[model samples]
Target: MFLHLGGSTVISLKGVIGIFDYSLTKTNHVNNYFNNGKKIIKICEDDEFKSFIITNKEIYLSPIAANTLKKRINSQNFTEKVNILQEHPTFK
Candidate 1:
């Protein structure tokens, strides 16, 4: 799923696997946030502080759906988890 936040910026939630099993989960929070028009907000006083709150709120409210968003916001790169299906000859 891809979310376009007003401008050119976009949030992509792809290749997300749920706990217990490597099954893809639907990103519901992203849709809800966008639909509610809470993507961007304007703050007059303590702009920096308010910005932080907005960012944190976005993450706290949505964990599974916001996994990719959190990574991007925190400047962390995404790395796929190793697949269990692949066989390692060294282990055998």
Candidate 2:
């Protein structure tokens, strides 16, 4: 499954490591680390991101809230489980 961060930015959930709240990255160490990295991708145009999505390839600044992103992940997992269950020989 894929997660729409913002704008035209969409990433695969399989590569995602963690989703962190924006405020959590406000510390000097966190801010400096992310800001200095060239691999950091900001999804929104402005500095109004709500969360940080750390993936295998790069770090993404998403406009969506952390809680909301977690919910999306859970929803995807639930859908996959449902599909698996339906495909089981016992269910058929």
Candidate 3:
């Protein structure tokens, strides 16, 4: 599944190692990660910034809030479950 990180940015859920709160994740810490060749992609919505970090060698700064992204993840998980059930013979 692919998660929309706001704007044109979307990432594969399989590669998402972590989803973190930007307030707790310091800028300097992210910069340090960047220096190590970890790619950083920022998705901005207007001027507001509520970034979520996705690290799987690369770090993505999503414009969406952590809580909101969590909700989306949960929703996707639920959808995946439903799809799986539907594909099963017992479900029919």
The model with the greatest lDDT is: 2
How far off is model 1, as Cα RMSD? 15.3
- Residue-level lDDT of model 3, residues 7-84, one tens digit each, is 887777777766765654445654555578776676775355676565576777667777687778787773442111
Order of quality (lDDT): 2, 3, 1
User: Per-residue lDDT of 1-92 in model 1, one digit per residue for the tens?
Assistant: 44322224344434222211111112344335435544333222222211111232231122222333343434544354412211223323
Please give the distance, in angstroms, between residue 28's alpha carbon in candidate 2 and its true position after superposition. Answer: 3.3
**What TM-score does prediction 1 earn?**
0.18
How much does candidate 3 score in TM-score?
A: 0.67
Clashing pairs in 2: none
> What are the runs in model 2 whose C-alpha is more than 4 Å off?
35-38, 78-92
Among these predictions, the greatest TM-score belongs to: 2
Clash number for each model: 0, 0, 0
Candidate 2 lDDT: 0.70
- How close is each model in CA RMSD to the real structure? 15.3, 11.7, 11.6
Tens digits of per-residue lDDT, candidate 2, 13-80, equal 77776677777674665667676654988888557888888777798888888878777768777343
**Each prediction's TM-score versus the true structure:** 0.18, 0.71, 0.67
